[model samples]
Target: MSKSGDDQVRYEPAAPKKEQGGAQKPASQKSRPLLEYSPVYLLVTIMLTLFTAEWLIMIILNMAPGIPQEWATLINALALTVVIFPVVYFFHYRPKVRDLAELKRVSLVLTESERRIRSVMEATNDSIIQINEKGLIVFWNRAAEALFGYTAKEIMNKKFLTLVTSPRYYVFFEKWFRNELDLVKKNHGDSMGQGQFEVFIKRKNEKVIPVEVSLSSVWLEDSLHTICMVRDITIRKKAFVALKESEKRFREALEKVCMVTAQVEANGKIMFCNDYFLRVTGWEKKDVLGRNLFALFIADKFHAALKKRLYESIAMRVEIKQMEQEIITRSGDCRLVMFNTTNLLDHKGRVIGVTIIGEDITERKKSEEIKKESNERLRKANEELQKAQTQLVRSEKLASLGHLAAGVAHEIRNPLNIISTSIQLLSMEERLSPETVKTSRIVMEQVKRASKITENLREFAREKKPEIIKMDLHDFLERTIALVEYEMSLENITVVRNFNSGPIYLLGDEDQLAQVFLNVIGNARDSMNEKQEEFSYDELQKRGWVGQLVIETIVNEHMAGVRFRDTGVGVTRETKEKIYDPFYTTKREGKGTGLGLAIAYGIIENHGGRIEIESDVGEGAEFSVFLPLATERNA
Candidate 1:
């Protein structure tokens, strides 16, 4: 780059940018004021001499005047006083006045220069500094203040050598700027902007700073002065550090995303590997970085393809697409990973390295296989039945997911309701009360959030309006039972039931009631799954239960009820109390959303009926649902 002065962004490992062949721009004039030395003293000397000459003339006048004796004596006294006063004033006061004037000029210039330098430095993203020949900081700009945390005033006139550790470099600077070097330069005539050097500087806080030092000989009043411009390259150094850290973090995160990332340099060096890669390949970082790309485990298995894709990426400077390959793990197990290669380019767009991203798609591939088998089994199962089983199973899966959405919404609603109510109540409090007012408002805001969640649950479940129909309750339970029968049988669950035959009728939504049956039955099935492996016959008998599940139905004059009893592991006392809440479930993580009973309760309430549940932790649970019979309907 073209430069009258070099910006200090030094580095030892990397060469500085070569000077570009371009038109040279004229160097701008330096803005700092010239230091005053002889001129100030000369001006003071001239003024004092003129004052003395006037005093002498006055003294001579007093000695030679023609006058009366008394008048002449008074004139001599006045003349002596005049001469003495002038002499005292010049000696004492006038010099002080000249010093004050010079000080004012110096201060004004310093203030103006400080302002300009501060403005430029703060405006720049980089830091600027000036170190004198003795390596003392004479000037520091505002950006330096921000970067190093030291103000100009804090370190001014202090030996700059103290800031830099190992002041041996000061020797190099001294020799470079000494009069011995200048004579050589003067003999050569007009040597400007030469012998520019780069070195790393340490900040006041001991941060390693990179800088470029430019030595320029400029004449100010016929004396040679060297002004070294220091630019701090902390940011560039930080970038280099960040890039390395990012590579490390990338490897760590990839372990979770389950990918193998490798960097291949120009000389075919395999620059990185993570835990999974090592576990799979029996190789460590020692076995990687700077090693030949094709020498690692399973290299021959993938070496040719990798080299081909690598060359393609490097040549094209674009990403190479997914390449499937297998590598033997350190455990002697082979895992499949789909690899992608990309070229890492420099500022000039030359490919300097290649980054390969490999994802272990083995699990995904296995999942696809399992899905195929499940699909075949499902197809066979469907063929053995009507559309009802297929529809019901799908609905149950969707319902399970919907339970999450609904529970979130239902829980949110209560809080949201609380918030809204609190906000309203707050306004009714005495006006302009900050604490009370703020709390109330915050409560309402939270209530609004809950309300939104409720709305979302409604949308997710497609549950907006209650649909009513008179339906046989037993028939509903029978269908839901059939839907889960295969799942229960797979777990070897025994179901017991006793039905008191009666002409029972209920006025309620058939599908919603069915939902209640499905939820209850599903919970019963889960409990059975839990106890299937852990319980013995003796333990089951102690719980007032014999097996996994029991279903019983009965009808009376007022209401028809179904008692769903499960011998599966039951709910805790606490769980029983909250069983009817919208989103409460205890089927373990990722299993239940705790919303089944809540929805069932809502449906029952809408039907002018109610639901109840009873549970014992080690024993089992029973859910009894009652629905009021329709007026005049047979019971």
Candidate 2:
């Protein structure tokens, strides 16, 4: 072999380099050929040797006369093929084969390394999870199965937000990220460094555990992978919580607040309640912990409802007002309290617990209630004063009516006296003119009409005791109608009875009931005056000038009621309010004496019955009357 080992011209086996101390590369990789053993030299040497040998052999063969030229050519070809093929194939072609084997070895090493890594990941005891920057779980490992009561298959390919009772943190992240992008837009700088933050994770059971982690970005092929590493510190958290409780009383006292102290989980459960809580609930410490906050401090019927609302509020990351709520104190006192609830969130904006503050407002409520009752009594006294004033006005109007009636009566009576004496004298003469007799008779008729006016005024003034009897209300209505039927016919008013079919019972005097009916019907007729033309009334024919009047009776077991509604010209809202007062009317002075409705109102009130009137300017008027049934009245 050549000293440099390059002239050997064979593919050398891999041999470890002999070195001092430090490692060295194999000979196959580091060794190189000498200048004489170059690829070009090897090729030239073979060619030149073949050329020289062939010439010598050809010369020797020529001297053999017995050999044919074609046979000589064939023998030279065979010899050249045997020797030249072995040298060129071994030195030149075999190195290419070595290169192919080396490539396979490298590929095998890469595959083995990948397999070992995969095995370690699957075998790890602690949960090895992969999540995107959005906090969605990309992978779940066996360690996760042991820690959380979920299989890897259950969590794979799902967002980490699914296990959380409230997903507000996710929403916050999206908002924060958007804000970061906005910052990037404004400054045109990399926001990736500033945007990364740790987020708390909640388990499927609604236990929120703080985690320590960071974000990393990788370019895999042409895609980006954002990864995070998470660890559960629930035990550490509980220890920290216990320590806080040990210090809460001291802190609250130092803070100079009498507010009841409590520790609620992020999901709104009461984990620990202070001595104040036990005092309020009337229960020992055992009764407070492990109970939903809503149950301990609120009504049972709304527990399910409040739970849902609370969850939604947490999801939205909002605080709730502790409005007035009832709570059973430890002393069995159910007191009303006004409460305020605020969320306790972490640095990452994750809800850790709810903080509630409540104050008793019952005494304040009682004082306000007493003030309300006093005001109501004062209001009732004022209404009675108003009624008394109305009575005085009605009494004055009656005195005026009496004076008018006396004057009218005197004027008619003087003329009637003259006519009557004249008629008697004429009759004695036995030859009286027909006109004279007619004149006397006409004067008498006018006097009688004046007297009728006097009679109506007297009837209005009269106050009579009711005569009680079991009578059909319908018959009473009919009799009253008959009295006014002639007047109605003259006015063309149509009376409609949605009147109940009954031996409709009532306890009342016939005369008093008649008086009541007279005033009510008279008032209705007066209202129809404006609609006379519309109802086709012609005073000459005594035709249909009256509007429809509906009287409806409603009977219930405890009471018998009647509703009288009219389609006549309705009263205005202002007039309707004062319609039941004495001497209130829209009729002209000569046309009506306004005592009719006033008298009706008084009579119904004296009977312990109520009349309710509902009317608007154009919608017409309805009046309902209610009186207790006879049996109820006796009771």
Candidate 3:
């Protein structure tokens, strides 16, 4: 054939059709002619026409009957061959041959197209399948074979939906397929509309996998067929589920974490805050979001500095670790906070904002301060305890010495008494001279003084229990002062009494308590007398220096106190420490036994009372005696 003729019959795959608006439709293969005559039909028609023409020609020859049968048959054969053969060959046989050649070429084109389509479907990772109107599988690619674990030979003509879909989806799939078939038939299969869905499909091994299926309809011959592109989405589904779980855990951690956490923009605007942050700052989500962090929570005094520092840190992309500051709460209370900050970065590692974690340390600071104060108090208490311990040790020694002195006093008193009797007998002799009488008198005086010293030693050793009774403290002190009134007057000492308005009462032995008061009074008088001796009478008069012994009675809810304040030479610290020891005297020889204060100390201690001394050298001394009141003792 000619090149132009070959071109006319040549077939190429259809290009996509363009609509009026220039939109191109999907390319689809065109349908073949609706009425096409087959080879057998053409052969039958030609044979019948030849038979009718020859029969008429033979009848005409027979009607002549003049020539023999052989010549007549030859004539008939020649006419039929010459007249019908050319017409049949040219008008029918030749055209049919050309048609046969064209069909063969078209077949080759279709075969090549099919080969290319198959190659494309096999190359893709997604499974491609085609199902006919009967819902039977007609086409399956290599990907389909790998995906479903079923070879094309095995799966051909098999029911696709029934084999792959689970039983629970049977009704749904049936309805869906029916509707899709109706749609395809209504469009005459020209509309290659596609639908995509995710569904579970069972593999040949009976293991189910999640898959995404895309369906498009196509007309094959006269029947509508569905084309499916199946992609295994098992990994995608798992990744989606894992991502959701990770988000859930992250959200829960933010809500439940103890530290206050927030995200702020570089400009100090809050972007996000956790539940703990909202709770600590006493702010609602709507109120706090997008607000300035420093303006809302930091004090005015710290606002500028804190904001500047935060801006600097953000600009430099520096992380703050344990930076301490104060944050004001909604209630106008300040909380000490330690902050840790980290830069929040974008995908390109550029800083966008910051993440802040604040730890409240207010209580920790208060506890440390309290601990410091407690340590200081404990130190002072320890010192006071040590002083009391030393005083107790000294008292114990004095008591032991008293016991020894008492024994010695008892032995010496007997000899002094025997000597006194001998002296009385000797003095009774009439022949004795006046000198002897005087000498005996002097001996008696010395013996009497020694006896007094022994008496005081015996008294110091005595540990007599108090005869308890309730007595008016004022009257008791008054009576004791009256006993020393004459002696105080002889020493040119003036007594002053400052008594409480109400009667102060105490429970104690009257005699022992009286002895304590008298001893204190006598010491005061002696100290004043010694001070007065420092100035002669003329100098004392000229200076107007009068020795005063001020007695005061003080009362409290728990105790009754008597204060003896004297204008006398005061005791030194060293002297005060040993002042209450037996025989520890500052008086001249033969003047004092020094047992007075010691006995008084024992008596006051036994009465559940105490004596406190306050004195300075040359500033005189004040001795306060405190005894439990009657009401306090009874209670």
Using TM-score as the measure, the top candidate is 2
Full-model lDDT for every candidate: 0.65, 0.64, 0.81
Residue by residue across 420-471, what tens digits does model 2's lDDT show?
Answer: 6775676577666888778767776765665555555555555555667676
Please give, for residues 1-635, the per-residue lDDT of candidate 3 as tens digits.
Answer: 00122221122343344465556574333333313557787687668767866887777777886888798778777766776677556654676677777768876887798668767877988898887777778778789899999987778778888665667665655665677778755654455667788889988899899999888876555466678899999999998899789857976787789988888998889988888887777879899889998888988899888888888888898988999998877888888889899898875788988889888888998998999999999999998899679768867876797788789999999999999999999988999999999999999999999999888888877777889899998888878989988778888888998999888888999999999999999888888888878767568778776778999998856889999999888999998888877778998887788889988988998898888899998868999999999986483
Q: Could you tell me how far off, in angstroms, the CA of residue 174 lies in candidate 1 after the best superposition?
A: 3.4
> In model 3, how large is the Cα lDDT of residue 404?
89
Clash number by candidate, in order? 12, 12, 0
The candidate scoring highest on lDDT is 3
In angstroms, the error of model 3 at 466 is 1.2
lDDT by residue (33-56, candidate 1, tens digit) is: 222336787577657656765676
